[model samples]
Structure formats: C-alpha cells, structure tokens
Target: MVRKHLLAIGGALGLGLVSAGLAQTIEGLDLGAIQSRAVEQARDAEAFLSAVSDRGKDARDEARQTVDESLAAVKAIDPTKLPKVGEAGAIDLDEMVSGAQGSLDNPRSAPLFIAFASLSMPEDSLKQMIADVHKAGGVVVFRGLPGNNGRMFAAAMRRVVSQDASGNVAIDPRLFRAFDIKAVPTYVAVSTGFTPCDDFACKSRVPPFDRVTGNVTVQYALESLAQAKGPGAPVAGAALANLVRHD
Candidate 1:
C-alpha cells in the first residue's frame, strides 16, 4: 500500500481552516500559534533542502571514486608486455578498426582518441562526432561526469550515441592533460601503444603523438596528421586506411 501522510498536505490545510475558524469565532484571535506553525514549516523546508544538498554531494563523491578506480585499473596495465601489431595471437588490428566499442576497457589501445565534451558541441554535431569517431575506430574521451553527477553524465552520453555506439566512449581527464588539450573536440593519434602512468605529476613517456584542436571530422584530422609525417604519421595512416576500407 502506498502510504500518504495526512500531515503532509491535508494537515496543513486543516490547520489553515482551523486558524480561519478561530479568527472568525474569537474577538481577539492572536496569530501567534499560526506564526509558530509557519516558522516550523520554514525550518522543515530548510532541512529538506539541506538533505537534498547532502545527497547530491554524496552522489558526486561516489562518481569521482568510480572514475578514480577506472583510471587506476587502466594504469595498472602494462602495454609493453602486450603483443605488437603484427604478432600472432595478439590483438587483431582489423577487428579493432572495425569494432572499437569498449576501448576504454580493452587492453589494446586505439590508434587515436578524440577529446570531447557534451556541453561543448551542439546536439546534432556531438552525435555526428560520436558516430564518426566510432566509424574511424577511435575512442572518444570525456573529462568527467557532467556536473560531477554520474546520472547526468550518463544521460548526456546517451543523448549523443546509441546503445551500440556507447562502447567507444570513455571518461578520463588524464588523457586531456596528457595531450595538453585546452579545448574540446581535440584529436590525438599515438604511434606507439598507451600505458597510462599512475603519477599525475610525472609526464608519461609515450611514443610520438600528433594532436590537433578544432571541430574537424575524424577523417580530416587523421589525413592531416598522416600527411604531415609527424610522430603519429604511421598510426594515423593506418587508421585512415582502415576507416576508408570500412566506409
């Protein structure tokens, strides 16, 4: 049975009616009792607000802890010990290129990653960017939970990608700092694999990488990086070829 508290709504109305009745019946009806009740209601409202604030803070704390655990798990992986690109029984490059969902959880890293924020791009643009990144076999990284709330972040991500495309999404601010990404929609391609370090202060000694900041298509970014023959040229070239083949 759904219990409804009479004291919550009807009780307040009844009190108001009683006060009105008393005021009509008594020649000198002082409103001290009504005033006291009003003050109590005000205090109850304040207490309710405080409780809500505390719950929100607890939710944020939990979300932050979850992100931290994910970061630590990813960092503990040793990329150097994994098989190389061409080694047998190792990760299949073709498979990764075709379906890179859950790249955040996968031990094998993608050739490129897209730094993104739901608030930074228009709704249509953000959806298109996520689809494009998925097609290009690249991961899309968000800095953290939106409003530091997990539910809000999940809702925002769901609005961007469909269920199938959700796997390519990840949440980690370290990648943003690692690539020196000052703005959203930044692209980074790394020639060597990624093995995130635990220490935030220490600069990760990673292989050559190419970075571009703008609102450009993943294909365009890859083509530009490959054409420049920069540190990420090799990886970008491969990713571009795979994207073309899949398209």
Candidate 2:
C-alpha cells in the first residue's frame, strides 16, 4: 500500500500536479517540528539497539537500516505538504530563480547564505525563526545531514513542521550537493541565481562571508550573516540579532 501510494505521488510530481497539492499539505509541516520528532525516534531506536545483547554486527546493521528506512518514509511526505514552487504570495525558489534570471541577466542577486549541519538547532528557537521568515515572505529548505547529528537535526525539524499548512519549508538532501558545502557546520551565501544588471552593475549587494567553528548555533550564525549585510538593513540585522539573543 505504501509503495502504491509512493508511486501515485511520484506520478503526481511528474505531472506538475504535486506543487498544487504540496502547498496545502505543507501548512502543518515546519522545519523545527520534524527534526524534534526524528530525534525522539532515533533515541528510542538507540535504546532498543543497546538492549539487544548478543546480536551480531550484521544483524544490528540490518536493524538500523530498518529504522532508517522507516524514518525516510516519514520524511518523504514532507514536501507534499508545502506550497508548489511557484504558488502566488509564496516565496517560491522556482519563481525567485525565474525572476532572478531576468533581472540579473548580467550579474546575479546576492548569493543566499547556505548552511549545512548534522545537528538540529533548538526547536523553539528554530521554529520561531522559521515562522518569522514565513511572515516576512521568505522560504527555508532543510536538507538531511550526513551522520547522527544530521539525523537528529532532520528529525527535530520534521516534528515542528509536520502539521504545517503553508508548504513553505522542505527537508531534502538532494539540494545539498548542488550548493557544494564543504563542512558539516558551514554557511555560504551564494550568488548563483542573480545575474548582474549590466557589465558593470551588480544586482543585489554581496555581503562578507565568514565561517565559525565549535559549539555552533544556528541563530547566532544567522544573525552574524544578517549583520554582515550592514547596519542600514535594520530588518535583517535587528531581527536576526533579536532571535539570537532571545534563543
């Protein structure tokens, strides 16, 4: 039954109908919510594995695989709940790219800051930030991390947005490679989509980019990124700083 349903979903996606249904379904699935739930499930699985004494290494590996597959299934449904790539009033990446292509035909808009990490940020903080972005007419896309930290983070985000109705955020790993991230906890504001206005004109202002290490927190790093834009951009700088301090 699950396979059949998945197949139907795939068909829908292929037909471009998935986007229409996605926005409505995504209203309840927020990034923070999903990650929290995934973390809990992973802890439970760990406890179960620890209790299984005398199990061969192969057996344990198989059990872990089963757990992972179950988790993946849960995550698969997330995208459907979000709005399609070009829904009106929604910050659709597709639309952004299209508009960018036209406006930045010469030089692109400022690069978006991309962060890749394995661990989830605090649920309350992350969710609130996501909510703020949504209210500000922005979109967030969460991708799966590589190791335990990644899984836990993915789970937590899943829990927060599972019931979302906007279909604004997404959690997928495929998009990660496209950004060419080097470290687990890294941020890079890219300029891939925006084209320069002309040979000498830039589309959006490019901000300074830097990386931090150890005990890294999402809110703080995001705040720093916003601040890099300059003090005059009160909305981004002030909002991010407030979130970091509060978190």
Candidate achieving the largest lDDT: 1
How do the residues 115-161 of candidate 1 rate in per-residue lDDT, one tens digit apiece? 45545588777887767777777777665434334223333444565
lDDT of 2 at 192: 30
Candidate 2 lDDT over 1-247, as tens digits, reads 2222112111111101012222322432333333334554565345434444355776556555654654554444444444342322322222111111122133323224334443355555555545544433333444432232322332344444322313444332322334444455554444233322221111233333344333445456555656666422344454455444544
Model 1 C-alpha lDDT versus the unseen true structure: 0.47
Candidate 1, run of 10 with poorest lDDT: 10-19
Candidate 1 contains a number of clashing pairs equal to 1
Candidate 1 Cα deviation (angstroms), residue 207: 2.0
- The residue ranges of model 1 lying beyond 4 angstroms of the native Cα positions read 1-111, 199-203
Model 1 error, position 69 (Å): 15
The Cα error of candidate 2 at residue 171, in Å, is 3.2
